[model samples]
Target chain A: MTAQSDQTTANADRIIISVDAMGGDNGPSAVVAGIAKSADKNPQVGFILHGPEETLRPLVDKRDVLSGRVRYCDTPDVVSMEDKPSHVMRNGKGTSMWSALESVRNGEAQGAVSCGNTGALMALSVIRLRKLPGVNRPAIAILFPSTNPQNFNVMLDVGADIRADARDLLQYALMGASYARNGLNLKRPRIGLLNVGTEEHKGRSELKEAHGLIAQFTDQADFDFVGFVEGSDISGNKADVIVTDGFTGNVAIKTGEGTASLIGALLRQAFEYSILSRLASVLAISSLDRLKKRIDPRRVNGGVFLGLNGTVVKSHGSADATGVSAAVKLAFKLAQSGFAERLAARVASTVELTQDAVELADPVPEHQKEGQA
Target chain B: MTAQSDQTTANADRIIISVDAMGGDNGPSAVVAGIAKSADKNPQVGFILHGPEETLRPLVDKRDVLSGRVRYCDTPDVVSMEDKPSHVMRNGKGTSMWSALESVRNGEAQGAVSCGNTGALMALSVIRLRKLPGVNRPAIAILFPSTNPQNFNVMLDVGADIRADARDLLQYALMGASYARNGLNLKRPRIGLLNVGTEEHKGRSELKEAHGLIAQFTDQADFDFVGFVEGSDISGNKADVIVTDGFTGNVAIKTGEGTASLIGALLRQAFEYSILSRLASVLAISSLDRLKKRIDPRRVNGGVFLGLNGTVVKSHGSADATGVSAAVKLAFKLAQSGFAERLAARVASTVELTQDAVELADPVPEHQKEGQA
Candidate 1:
């Protein structure tokens, strides 16, 4: 049995995931349908759905694949997309989002999935799941489609917090590397610090410092530290993991998505431009469909919250049934692999390694060092 | 005659643009061919080419379209891609980049186009032409293909300077709006402040301040302020001008390009996947070509240096003859419209309006304000 299953009350044969069933644009029905789709494909998966019982029970009953494997944690209140994180944290006891995270907090579920407001979800996750021992700030890590052999690259701190100091960036590198290892099944993922340029002297001073710190721990952490990478390298094969401050990462992620969406729209316009083009589009339907499937944003739907005590996956607020299913599948895989426990251990060991390195370099007693300053 | 022609030494009927014919990846031959193409299409355009006489004379002479319309300013030195901006500024007097800018400074050309290193070129432009009065920092504004009727959106501070405070961002809005007005022929452009979210309380403190500052000047500037816009709106029809700090703008620009390039690559892969797809590719060649042209980066190849005393267009360093022609065409259009003079007047008037508004709001003397602080 995995470390996560040891703590959970769930059956040894099944992995239980706590899911918030409300607040998505498509409503509870889409969430139910998504979980049902996941359950039908993965026999080892079960769910504890959180929402109003009357609303969710009927939806769950409609899916035969979800029978007997689903449990309900009914909470009437739902977090809206416009809700403030602070307000949600203060008066969230009866909310479905809060109740969903309760299952993970109490060790009843190994992982959690939510399609609520990202800020509120992140706030609640931090309060309930807590931070890993060595983590300063938690980050949102998402997988981006790329030309790598694995076909995806992991990028972190997409919008967890806007500010990251040198130490925070170093932790991101470590956390991002661990996520790639368990999430993408890479043995030694290459970690890259995102910058304006590849040159060592370019970018903010904190990045330069983070570069040295990340390189120092690469050998001990079992990840290759590729120096600095530019924005173009985000979708390239140069690095398996890209780390940056949340502010820059958030802008980069949104810009990339916007560009892709625009290209897709323009391509449709192109196929319908002329009669000959329309005929060609009809003949090329299967070819175009294959291309569409390859770059489909729905297939890569979850932003996993890293540096937390327990795993939580945040689905897009506007996610459809397919997008929610993708998130659920990702949560299940991470749970089965005991990603949370592995990440905790990885961070704890790195902190210890850093302290030892600091002591060796400075050659000063910890107590006496304070007086020197 | 236009305002640009009234100041230039060349014939009033011809708009002369200084062409830096060195430092690009393809060398002076490509630059000469690009100018030749532009000259053939535009009978009223002339060139003052800057490069080594021995190398550039033959290239220019080979193009019959450029005969009797090209003047050479022989400069033996060239700036390489690896040269630092500071180093270039101190020792780059003999380089083609400096000579090209000199032509603009001396009123021999209305604008200058260069495919040299961006840093060195920007540095040289600033040193030779200087910044417009009341403009704290200059910016590099590029045109992005968008869903607007004009087919492009203007984004500023792509990498002129990394940090933009409230005042700097406000200036970006003014400069970007002016660029849209003249470059895209928009009567009253809609400007948006780029942030992580559209909410008023969402981004960094500077963005919030910039939002307020920009809104105050919209009526006086003859543009509609669209409040906060996210990265997705960079290519959306919500705004024609997007303004942000150079750091965020640079990342957003590169991310958009990288994503577009990735999609293009994936499309090629999809069409080559099977026998039926290959047949469809042949049939849909024209349709696909239309799509390619619509979104082609080469077609929109210039990043105009805004808030400068003179017009300077920076082409992509790896640009080909077609790309170079596109940059030259953009420079010619901006010169014909006398964009630099119009932008300077717009900024000057806004600065005066701001001082008047501040005086009216506070009712305090500028000399006595320091004592109050």
Candidate 2:
């Protein structure tokens, strides 16, 4: 084991991650395999796996690395992909997803990981862990593969809530910057507001207002505001963190993923076109593998729920062992760094800054001023 | 010559497409070369090249295919990439972009092609050619590389006007369907309203209203409404034509382009990683070439400005010879199909249908009905 893992293992308080084991497409086996992989990598990490014990016990027993590192929370139900968030919120108490999050709520785990329905997960999280102080709406932040030195850029509001006013956007910038600081190890992440164009006059009124709000809080928030960034800059090195309303952010990321998938499909067809190219593919396997790894969605397979009281990493519903492991790794890292507490502190200061800026922008009349009285 | 080219060549009056020759990254040389390529392929097409004659004449003389097919309209001023649209609208009388649109305005050319600033081109087109009757706001439509049998899907309002209401979206659905009919030769295109999710309950209020408005007009609009589509559907076969607000559309396309470019860059790096990969790249040249050609933005380099009095194809400002040629070809095709007239007719009918639908929905209380008197 590495010295870092040894140090963590030697510590009295080992980090435990809450994981929903039944909701993923591959079921509890893949989730168990994923946790085993995480256990092999980090000796200090433990899992509070939630699922039907009969189904998950056998899978966990098969993995040697997970022998004693896991604790079970038996639950009968699973949140299917099609379950409505509202319906699930009311009736999801017996589900594995709810049990998984309960561990985090009860302080049994530092963070939670789930591959359940995103809507249900968000709803359950809001009801259980609750939103951070002064946060109007929580945002789902994702790591986009980019040209930055860090190899990824943080983008927020990828669809927690579709509508974000100027205040919400400002909070996203604050939370996203804090995410970059902890998640990507950036000292002072540059925050860019996503817009149709980079020009100040472009985009809607809310965006313009958000621009001013985010810019005003830069100094106190401890981040650089790169003004407005175009969609192209999401994967470019212009900013370390990109902020936008959930509606636009969700669409932009999905569009980017679709385009990448299309290119990959096209490339596969091209290589299989001829016998000579087939032979060439063998020789180019390592290089192609490197390329695939560089842009693999599986490697960065976690969408973090930001602005919440606790950290929750939502793995892709269709994630395999590799993807699930990546999510676990992310959840473990956030837990180790105490990201949620830091984020809460960052957001709390941001809310205070916003109040100050608002007062400054719209000064109270001298006759009605509270201090004057 | 092919039978198609011979048929066009034998026509009494050849189609003249106005070409703005000064603003592309490659300058007049690329524009002249591009038109020359178009001239060689389409015997029915001629060009009224707009720029300084001294600069363009030599370039045109060098291409034998362009020998009498090109007509120069000397305009001394050039619209630079950085020129503001508002400023250009007022002071761009003598510029190449303005002169190019003027040809279309005066019926000297059937359509116009510009490799100038998008804002300037859009601004000038609005001023010179004007909006088609009943078009609240004009939209810029582009063909995206997709998995459809046609290998392209039409997406619109990509930076034409950022704000699109339910009515504007409905109009876009009409105009986009009409474009697909002429441009892609789809008899009945499937129109999808771009949103954050495919569910009826998702997205903003305007999208929900647009869904209803578009569904009501499907039969009249001569298209199939696919309800709401997520950003992934842009390149998927779920819809043939995707309609969205300019802000979202613009951002989505740019994000797609950026992702594609990033993959291409990563592929290049992978090939150069080692000796084995280098040898493999040489052997796989044909395969790589095929893949590159399939996704090359240059091959699909035109954004058609719909809902205008005349068709205007906006080539990328950074477009090279090949890219410019694609724009000219699109302009010629649109001109040949009388796309402007057909689109205007479609929009006019859509407006009438919308009015009828509105009246039906809000029947002025029975006592105050229009026919009461």
Which predicted model would earn the best lDDT?
2
Among incorrect, acceptable, medium and high, the docking class of model 1 is medium
- Top-TM-score structure, candidate number: 1
Residues B1-373 of candidate 1: C-alpha lDDT, one tens digit per residue = 0112222344457988999999999899888888888888888899888888789878877888887788788887999988989999999989999999999998888999999988889889889899998888899999888888888899988888878988888889999999999999999999999987888878888788778778888889999999998888888899999998887888888888888888888888988988888888888898889878987888999999998899999999888888999999999999988898899999998987766554554478767978866
lDDT of 2 by residue, A30-77 (tens): 888888988898888888888888898889888888876777788889
True contacts kept of each: 0.64, 0.83
Q: What is the DockQ for all candidates, taken in turn?
A: 0.71, 0.75
lDDT of each: 0.87, 0.88
Encode model 1's per-residue lDDT on A1-373: one tens digit a residue.
0112222344456888889999898899989988988998988998888989889889988888887778888788999988888999999888889988898888878889998898899999999888988788999999988888998899999998988987788899899999999999999999999987787867788888888788888889999999999888889899999999998998888888888888888888988888888887887888888877877878889999999989899998888888899999999999989899899999998887766554554468767879866
The DockQ leader among the candidates is 2
lDDT of 1 at A308: 90
What local lDDT score does residue A308 receive in model 2, on the 0 to 100 scale?
85
Candidate 2 colliding pairs: none
Clashing pairs in 1: none
